[model samples]
Structures are given as structure tokens and as C-alpha cells.
Target: MRQDRAIRTRNLILESMASLFNEVGYDAATIAALVERTGLTRGALYFHFASKEDMARAVLDEAVTREGLSPQAFKLQEWVDLGLLLAHRLPREPILRAAIRLAVDPKARRLFGTRWPDWVALGRELLTEAKESGELLAHAEPAAVSRAFVGAWTGVQLVTEDLEEKLNLSEEIAGLYELLLPSIATPAVLAKLDLAPYRAERLLRKSCGQETPEHE
Candidate 1:
């Protein structure tokens, strides 16, 4: 199973690189550090990734891989779940943390671009679906709303990370939705939304084949 071994090696390199980048920004994630952390030879590392920039790009490519938010009857709820899930997992998921760090770092951004557009596109798609399903306010424009929401969500994450206890990110994000949703969502749909911090935990369990009760 050469393919399986190769996949495992690649994943190992990516995980080690993510941890290194999360701890110290992209510039500081030298090959030596990656090799030491992964306990793999420099040749093995180079076989998977030509350089640190290459590894950073690979991490950025998979920035949204862990986003497996289950489908919801309300598309807007899916959008909210996506943000909450990321908020819940970002601190624990080194790959996502590293990707965000690289995206925000001016130096690293020059080498590997940010995934803001991809996230914005995803939001726009969900919001468009929600709007078509009559879940949003009559005047809510999907493109504009999604763009603004993505920007606001990014700001919330940055501010939360700066706090003494960065673990409260999910709460901060839930509060953000509470403040913003009233303006974008219809009264009926608004009442149905779940903005609780624990929402992400439940969503994660549901994703892992656990039975999660549907929220109203």
C-alpha cells in the first residue's frame, strides 16, 4: 500500500507543519523545526513539500477541509453553524489555526494567499439559498451580506484570540450572530436560529455519527 503510506506521510508532514506554524508564524516554521517536530528526515519532508512556503500553501489549500457542517433545513442555519463550528474547532485544530495565522501574517500572505474569498463565496452561496427560501429579510442581498459577515467574523476571531482566554471564541461569535441576525433574518427564522456556544460541540458530535437532537 504505497499510496496509503504516502498519504500518511503527507498528513504527518502537514500536521507537524501546522503545529509549528501555529506556535510560531510561518516565517519561524523553519524546515529544521518541522523535521524536529515530525521526527522525520529532512529528505522525507522535502519529498512531501519542496519548502516551507510549499507546506504553507498546502495548509492553506486545505483550510476549509475540516468544515463538514451538516445540511440544515434552514440554509441560514447552515451558515451560522459553519462559523460556530470553526470558532469551536479553530483553537483545537492546528491546521486551521496555522492557516489563519499565515493568512493574517503580512510576510506569509505574500507567499501563500488568504482563503477569505473562498469563505466569502461559501457564505454567499448559503445566504443566497436562504434568501431564495424566504428565510432572510426582503432587502437582504446575499453577496453584500455574506461579504460583510465574513469580514465581521474574521474580526471577532482576531479579537477573541487577543483576549486572555481565547477559548471563549465560540461565545464571542455566538454573541456576534445575536447582534447581527436580527437585522438580516426574518422574525420567524430569527426565532429558529441557535446562536449558543455549545451549538458547535453538538454539531461536531452529529458529524461523527452521534445522534444529535435537531434544534428548533
Candidate 2:
């Protein structure tokens, strides 16, 4: 029970910190701000994190995980699923949003490097597997494609946040796949792919054991 309470408190602190960081970039977010945001004393916050940079680094550590994603028959499909899921979750998950913001912020990035490389590594791993499985076109290169896709994904996120307040990221990311996949995937593989924006929502419902409509 003590461990459970500690875990809950730690998570609460992280979540509150993430929200604060997202609202005001990393450099602007301070220990005092977090103390006010979490309604926890400075010591309490310090108990979980040594400093503001420490907290930001902790959030970055979670930036590239595949917690909610499941394995797919096609490794390429798995890669798509990961991106779509991130799009769906980013808006709702302050930690992820904050991590992305910090990664792009020059001051924050200089202090503590971003997780962009980790994301690219994961993408390359998945794409390499897909290539080995005969899912990619002859000219497609996993290393180059993975790096380009990560850059495109990051650009889409930044542009959407700046230009459209109400745009859905899942839809935007799905559009990205639709445009890029044709060049990377074989004709047969591309035809079999499901790049629907709502795929993540349906996947969540299925994971929760809730009945998703077949039409979706």
C-alpha cells in the first residue's frame, strides 16, 4: 500500500509537471510553478525530481515507448499503428505533448537533448523488419525513410499546433502515411494497408473490450 501511494503521488507530480511544461515551454516552466500547479510543497516535488531539468529528462525518457501498441502481422502495419496511436494520444497526454515541445525548444534542447534520435531508431528498426518481410518497394531504404518520416511527423505536429487549433492530429498523420506509403510500400502492401484516421480510436475500443462497429 505504501508503494502504491508513492507511485500515485509520483505520477501525479509528473502529470502536473507535464501540463505545466506544455503550457509554458521548458525554460519558462519552473519549480515554483510546478509547486503551485501540483499543490505540493517544493520538497514534495523535489522528492520525485531533483530539478526542473531532471523532470524534463524523465518525461523525455517516456517519449518513445510502445506501451499501448500491439504487434501486427505486417511490421509496416505495426509502424503505422504506432504513429497513429501517438497522434491520438498526444493531445490527451500532457507528458507526450510537453516532451515534443521541449524537444523542439532551442534552450531546452541545448540543456538536455531531445528524444528524436530514439524515435528515429525505433522507426528504422520497424521499417527494416518490414523490408525483410518483402513489404517495401525495391528502392525504399529503411534508414533514410525512417529519418524522413520522423522529420515529417515532427513537422506535421508543429504545424498543426501553430496553424489549426481544432485540427485532428490522427487525421493529419494518416494523411502523411497516405502520401508517403505509396513511395515506400509495394503496390500489394499499400493496397492492404488501413490508413484511416479513426483507426486508433477503434483500436482503443477493441483493447478495452468494447464493441467497435464493423463499419469503422
Q: How do all models score by TM-score? A: 0.89, 0.92
Q: In angstroms, give how far residue 41 of model 1 lies from its true place.
A: 0.9
Please give the CA lDDT of all the candidate structures: 0.86, 0.87
Error of 1 at 216 (Å): 25
What does candidate 2 score in Cα RMSD to the true structure? 3.9
On TM-score, the candidate that comes out on top is: 2
Q: Kindly provide the TM-score of model 2 when superposed on the true structure, using C-alpha atoms.
A: 0.92
Q: How high is the lDDT of residue 38 in model 1?
A: 82
**Model 2 over residues 1-216: C-alpha lDDT tens digits?**
988988899889888888888888787888888787788998887888888888888899888867556777889998998899889989888999988988888998998899989899999999999999999999999999999999999899989988846988999999999999999999998888889998888776666664643222
